[model samples]
Structure formats: structure tokens, C-alpha cells
Target: MEPVEINAGAYYLRQLRADRKLDDRPALMEAFADPRHRRYVLNYRLRTPDEATEYVTLRAAQWACDERCSWAVADLATGRLLGEVGLRDLDLDFGTAEASVWTHPAERGKGIAAAGLSAAIQFGFARLGLHEIAYRHDESNTASEVVARRAGFTRVGPEERPSPSGETLIRWVLKPS
Candidate 1:
């Protein structure tokens, strides 16, 4: 499925093109360099423009697959990359998917992540015919939990993932009203 652009009030959501049209390399690298972003996002630190190019290229490619779709959340006026939001691991039969979002450190506390996530959820439910979306984040990441709750998700419970960090993931679910 081809990804589509969305108007999200102060922000907009568009496909992350690896091409010059979207050219997110510099901004992406800067965000990854932030220690706080590195801790919560796990978006990983990119070493160079080439690596960033590859990163966005892969993210952009996810739209063509059946399981995931991502959008670059940008400031409407500046067109600067504010963050990213996605509906991933989609279960078409079950009408469900997982929501993921991360905002640049500089854009934090501005509601970019929450707004972007809400827009993605709307698209998934309306366009993709999804019934529910799950949001999960590290237990320590209060910011993400706040975003989830603000977007109308209800806390479900804790989930365990096999990882060296002993990560405790908090899970929340949102069903269509």
C-alpha cells in the first residue's frame, strides 16, 4: 500500500522519503545524538549521513509491506522533522496493530508525539479498518505513557520481553469508540 500524507493541525505526517524531497539525514542524526533520545527511542545513533540515509530508506520501505506503515511527523510551517509515528506489526485479520512514536529532543513537550500518534491511529482505524491499536513502552519512559494515555489508550498490563536490559514494557490498548 502506498503511504499517504496527513494534515495534523500544527504538524503534518508524510512518508519518509530517503530522497532529496524528505532529506531527513541531518535532523535525524541530531536527534540520535541526544542522550535522552537515545535512552527512550532506541532509534540508535547514526554515525553519518550515509547511515541516516539507509535508516530512512528502510523506514520508508516499510509502507510497501503489509505489516507496517510509518510517517515522518513534521512542523507544518517549517517542514522540519519533528518525529515519527507508525502502526506496525499489523494483523489485518484481527484488525489490530501496534503504535509507535518518538519525538526529537528539541521537539519534546510540544505534543508532537501525541498528535502524531493520534493521527496514525485515525488512519489505521479509518483507512486500514483496524479495530484496536496497542501501545507499549519501557516502564521507565513516562513520556510515552503520557502520550498513550492522552491519546485515549487504557493501560492493559505489563509485558515481558527477552532482553538483556530486563526491560519491563507497559502495554496499553485503544479500541474504537
Candidate 2:
């Protein structure tokens, strides 16, 4: 499938380019290594270059297979990788998917996540003919809550799930308008 690109004012949203995975690895690893950025994310440990490469490779495959629609959020002027926003667990039959966003530590509080997430939602609802898109984050992640609100998602209350730590993770979702 052809990758979709969205011009989101100061930032742009585009699929994680398979050809440029090598160049994107270092930034991704750095983002994962930062404590503040890693806390709320699942399976986000400090990664070796090889691990980052493997993860990026899988992301490319997932996108190609239409299992996920992850994109690299980048600054329009410098083309720096700002973060990522995506739809996962995409169920074409049900027209549903889970949305998520993460910003690089240096790029937080700039509305990058909100912009990228909004663009991804637009793609899911319009291009994919999605009936509903859900976004959930750990209840403790106030930052994600802010991004969800800014992206125009409405709260649908809490959900219980298992976390990487083997503890109950209480999360909440915002459904598409």
C-alpha cells in the first residue's frame, strides 16, 4: 500500500520509511533510553542498535501487511524525528483500531503528539473507513491524557489490562467522534 503523508502545520506525519530505518534507529534508541519517555511505554527498555534495527524492521513489516499504521512524526523544516503516532490492532472487519503517540523528550509540550495523532485519526476514519478508533494510556500518564484531549478524543472510562511489570494496568480510552 502507498504510504499516506499529512502536512500538520509545523510538523508532518508519514509512514516510517523502510529505506531509512538505519538512519532512524539512533533517534529511536535515544528516545527509549530517556527515563521520562520510557516510563509510560510498554517494553521500552534501553536498546542496542541491533534491537532497534529489529524493532524498526518489524514496524516496516507491520505497515506493509496493513497490521499497523505507525508513522514517524517529523519537524517540517529540519526533518528531525519528533516522535511517533499510529493505529495498531487494526480490524478492518470491525472498523476499529487502537491509537497511540509518543514524543521525544526534547520535543514534548509542543503539541507534536496532538498534531500527529489527529492526522493519523483522519487517515483511519477517512482512508480506512474506520467506524471507531480508540486510544488508551496508563491512567498515570497525564501527559498522554493531555494529548488525547488535544487530539479531540473523548474519554470512555477505565480498562484493566496486564502490564510488562506483571501488574494490573489501569488505562482509559477515548473514542472517535
Candidate 3:
């Protein structure tokens, strides 16, 4: 499949270009390296630009193989990366995937995550023909919870999973109707 882009008014979502080094690497690295946000994502803690580059490489490969999608959420005017929204653990046969989103610290309260995630959900169900799209977030992540709710996700209760930090993570899901 070709790379996908989702337009959503104030911001747009596009496939993460893995073949080239990201021009926004420094900002992205700073966002991912923030200890407060690191545990909520699937990747290891990004402590340096090199680690972030490795992440971009991995995400690029995943996008190329259609195993996952990592979309950059950019401002419509300046094209600044506000954050990212993606689908992971995609199972085409089952028409399901897990959705995740993260916003830059400066972009948190401006509706970036909710809007980006809403666009991603639309892409998953409408474009990708998915029957169900779920979202999972750590229990302590109230911000994620808010984003999920604002993005129209309903809570399916708590689930226990292992985290990179070795703690039993409490996760919740939101499925699209």
C-alpha cells in the first residue's frame, strides 16, 4: 500500500519517513526522552539523538511492511510536529489494531492529541476497513485517558501488562463503533 495521510483541519497526519533522518529529530528526541512520557510508549527510553534515530528506522521499516503506521501530526500552517498518532499490532484478518498518541509538552492542551487520534481512527476504520480499533494507555496517564475520551474511545476496563520499567502496567482500551 502507499503511504497514507489524514487531513483534519488544524493538523494533518502523514507517514513517518523512515528512509531519511528526520529534520525534527532534536524536538522529537526531547519529547521522547522526557522521563514522564517514556514509559507510556512501546519503544525503549530514548536518551539520545542516536536512540531516536534508531526508533525512526524501526518505525520506517514497520510502515514499509504495513505492520504498523506511525503518523506525524503537524500544524497545518507551519508544519511543526505537534505529536504522533499510530496503529500498532495490526491484524488485517481480524480488522483490528491498537491506537496510540502522544503530544509535545507544549501542544498538550491545544487539542492536538484528540484531533490527531480522531483522524487516525477514521483512517483505520474508514480507509483501512478495520472493524474495531482499540486504544491502550497506562492507568496513571490521565492525559491519555482524556485524549482517548475526547477522541471518542470508550473504556473497556483495565488490563495488566509488563512495562519496560518492570512494573505491572494498567492498560485500558477504546473500541470504535
Candidate 4:
């Protein structure tokens, strides 16, 4: 994976630039600071530039590989980050990966996750020649379920075990058309 950028309708998906440290600090801090984000996406809230920089470094490393790809969904006009969507646990042999998404607190309810996830699915099936993409999220996260459905993923039932978040894991799958 060479870290592709995508033109989502109201937003674009780009890898969070490792070189854009100054630009990414405030955006990441703002993105991960919310309680909602910490609860569902990550355990720690990005409070300082150093923390945000560390996160950027981690996400940057996820690129330049075949294993995973992550993108920052940004506003078209302002270029502010609206959220993130990614394919993780990629297995080319099986042409499969798990999709994940998170929206900025201020940008919630505007369909950001759905748009970003849809574009990533297209890239997976069309560009990467993947056969299927699996989407799994904490069952308590109704918003993720909505995004999966909106992006045309079929409900594949729930896992018997709970996710790390202590909620049952609901599963969905999207196959290439």
C-alpha cells in the first residue's frame, strides 16, 4: 500500500502527513480530545503536541505497506480534518480486510464516515483487487452500524465474545459488485 488519497464527496481522504507535524497537531488534538472518541476509538485523549505527534507517527507507519491503510477525511475547502477511515488487518492472500471509521465530534451526523468508508471500499475492491471487506464495530456503537449499512455492507451477525470495549461485536461484510 502506497498510501492513496481519495476524493470523497464533501471531503477528501489523505494519509496524515508525517511532515505536516505543525498542521497535524491541533487537528489531531481536536480530533481525539473528545470523550466520545476516546471511548470508542482510542483509550487516550490526545492532549498535547507530543501526543498528537506520536499518533501521526504511528498512522504514518501504517502506510508504505500491504498490511493496512489509514486516511484522514478532510474538508474540501478548508482542508480541516473531518474524521478518519481505514482498512486494517489486510490479507492479500484472502483478499480480505477489516474496515474502521471515526468522525470528528463537530462533524458527526453529516455522513462523514459513510462517505469515507465507501471510497475506501472502492479502493479495496477496485484498486487492490480485494474480494471482500469486513466491517466490525462495537455493538453499542449504533453510528457505526448506520455507516456500514449506508455503505451497503450486509449484516453478518454478532460475535459471541465482546469487543475490547466490553460491548458485543457486531459484524458486517461487503463484497465487490
TM-score of each: 0.93, 0.88, 0.87, 0.93
Per-residue lDDT of 73 in model 3 = 94
Model-by-model lDDT, in order? 0.86, 0.79, 0.77, 0.85
User: Where does model 2 exceed 4 Å of error?
Assistant: 17-22, 162-177
Candidate 4 differs from the real structure by a C-alpha RMSD in angstroms, to one decimal, of 1.7
Error of 1 at 130 (Å): 0.7
Candidate 2 vs candidate 4: the TM-score winner is 4
lDDT of 2 by residue, 1-177 (tens): 556778887889876543453266777888998887777776655488787777777777888888998888988876678899989998988998989789988888988999999889888988898888887777667888888888878786666565554544444454546
lDDT of 2 at 10: 81
TM-score for candidate 1: 0.93
Clashing pairs in 1: none
* lDDT ranking, high to low: 1, 4, 2, 3
Across 50-101, the per-residue lDDT of candidate 3 in tens digits comes to 7767876777888878788888898877567789889888888898898888
TM-score for predicted model 3 compared with the true structure: 0.87
**Which residue ranges in model 1 land beyond 4 Å of their true spot?**
162-164
User: Model 4: how far is 147 from its true place, Å?
Assistant: 0.4
Report the lDDT of model 4 for residue 162: 83
Which lDDT tens digits does candidate 4 get at residues 39-68? 787555579988887877777777766778
